[model samples]
Target: MSNATVRPLGYDLELISTIYISHSKNSVLPLLVASLMVNDISIIAIDGDHIDDVRTMIDIIQHLGAHCIQEKNRLIVDARDLQNFDANIPECSSTRYSLLLLGALSARLGKSKVALPGGCDLNRPFDFHITCLEAFGNEITVDNRSITCIQKHSPKTEFSLPYPSVGTTLQAIFSTVIGDSRLAIIIRNTALEPEIDDVIAFLNKAGAKVFRDDSNITVIPVGRGSLSAVSHEPIHDRIEASSYAFAAVATRKVVLLKNCPVKLMTQALTILEQLKCIFYIQSEHDILVDGRSIEESDPISVVTQPYPGFPTDLQPILAALCCTLKAVSHIRDEVMPHRTGYVKELEKIGALISSDGNKITIMGFESLSNAVTVNVSAPDLRGGMAIIILAISNGCDIRIESFNQILRGYSRIISNAHILGGAISHEHP
Candidate 1:
């Protein structure tokens, strides 16, 4: 496990200022792979900050025979001469998002094999993905370490997800777009997150016809070799934006987040407002958070749901902020029940928190002011961000084990913390 040391950098209220965050790479990865399904000599350029897991996915695609290159803020991919179909690599095993390769490669080639994915120990099962693939008439076999998928026949034209899972939705889309173009695929109860819409837009721009109505998504495939080259810029990272907003609130700093997707974060912004953190929507894509008023605010309640609801990803960060409040707060993560692994680590920092099933109750106290130097391991991605927020808010020295957990999602976290006047450094081993 990699470790990160966060030293106390006494808060300078004057140093708090605006920071620019790039578009969501989580929203970019599926599109990057989807671009490769198109057999075109024309280059597909994706504009975003590609680092950490995004870079890992790029490497995986290159290994699968796509010509991928990084040029500053853009990733250029040429899949015209694509050959390999196997993605059973160590890199794939390390990042869970690599599972999307199964669907993409299965459509491009008749069969594909990939190492079982690993990321945060969130207890998120890949069975939903396998179910979605099987719905498309694919044959799947699982070993202890890897999964192999083979196209048995033409994919099914209609399928409905038992739950609105984002990964499964993307899998269904990839399977349809690159499958038999004669079929018009219809998917019900699909996740309507901005990232899902972004992928649909990329597919449409690349010559596939995809439409979303309410909770259902319809894909009209344009057949293989018909999808031409296209360039797409992914939407800004709403989860990343919310994380910084929560940091500002936890530390009582005024932070202007540029390129933030204010609309996509309406639910999170509403919750922040209830906590007395004022927001100035400078533009459609920028928000200024005045968190100095948080002390006067009452504790708030949050329930995580799909898009347009308080995001489950921000639940841990909010729970951390609640610890610094003077009243009780309640949070229910209806999305992922086993996501409270960070509560124990937060307790080490003096947070009074408990969990019952998916419900969490936090007895708010001034834990930040009483924080002491501590060593903790990040339980997951957002959980690590929550830990760092507590340490930065309290100006407490902390050693965070398994720091790579944070890098899996937030590639620019260290640099962004530095911009916020945080004294943080990580050492890889």
Candidate 2:
């Protein structure tokens, strides 16, 4: 291994291992397995560690239990996790964008649904499920911290969101009508992250009514019908891909991300612009990044909110970038509680970051001097990965714990580091 110390970040990192699920693909693996079991699908995760073996596993998923278990669970099903789509619940197959399920479930199933919103609090700016349901003539009443939607006269026949809520977007589309009918949904001041578009496109593939204007989306509802099974690969995840790219920037090293789509990373690219990081987007899949000349940028401001704004997922990496800069920077996480607030780990990396509710004020420093072991618990995925970047950049042995959350986002991060020219990996003893 390189001279760099093996500093892992996260509160629970010490206990977990580089899990070799061998037989099954992870990401949303657990969720898929759960879905398979509940639906009585004939799918099983084996103990094999190769692509060919996993393909066989998918063959089982292709034809199995016909029933789908729509029970509620706090599952993180982003599009990046699946090797292939779920055939039984193709509508629900792609978990990453599963928030779209809220609409269809409510309409045909009579609006009875429960599911956890993923990503940090910043991810959910507005709840779209309620908006579309009310517009569709569904009597949506708040039930003590829970929302209940009851269809009353097939809804108002018109739906829109003050903001484009994925949950709301789905609700509006499904509530169209039993037959062909025209409907409109207003998604004003709404941001459309590429991932949201993934689900919209999927619905369109299934022949759902969907039309979007500058800020509003007009989705012609596709009434209940056994839509033909559609097959299409999910777009490569730019968020996960860019995190590694940001890692290269943190260490001031050159890391080329192949199989990555550059168009989706415009927002992160813009912020990196402020840092003066040189990014060469050669092809659709290739992104080469070289950092500034070890020079610190002036103090800057980063507010992490919903899409179109700086992503909350990138806040941790940006915070790591802030630490390298010898200036004051502000990262305000306006969504979750104490999310970017976890800048305390930055203190371990030798940066000054303070938490005040949803806002974080970071003071850039020249360098965080050498330290024995920098131990910190990761509050979430990006935050956790950032600690790894901080360790690599500052030459510190950072121990990150609570990797369970981090793994939900990044797949085989250590492998990524090993493949790239950044840090070395070591199993915790």
**Best-performing candidate as measured by lDDT:** 1
lDDT (Cα, 0-100) at 249 in candidate 1: 83
Candidates in order have lDDT scores of 0.81, 0.52
lDDT per residue as tens, model 2, 1-429? 568667763224332212111111222222232232121122222222222212322333333323322223222212211233222333222233343333443454455333333433334433455665666666755533334555566445444466554344444545552233554443444446564455455455545556667656665554454233333334565676767776776766655666676776787788667777777776887776665333475666977767667776677787787777778888777644457545777776676777777777777543555646667777666687787777777777666776544554555666766533445454543
Q: How does residue 61 of candidate 1 score in lDDT?
A: 86
User: Which pairs in model 1 have colliding backbones?
Assistant: none
Best TM-score goes to which candidate? Answer: 1
Q: In candidate 2, what residue range of length 10 has the lowest lDDT sum?
A: 15-24
> lDDT by residue for model 1 over 68-153, one digit each (tens)?
76776677788988878788889887788888888888877767889999877999999999999898878999998899999896
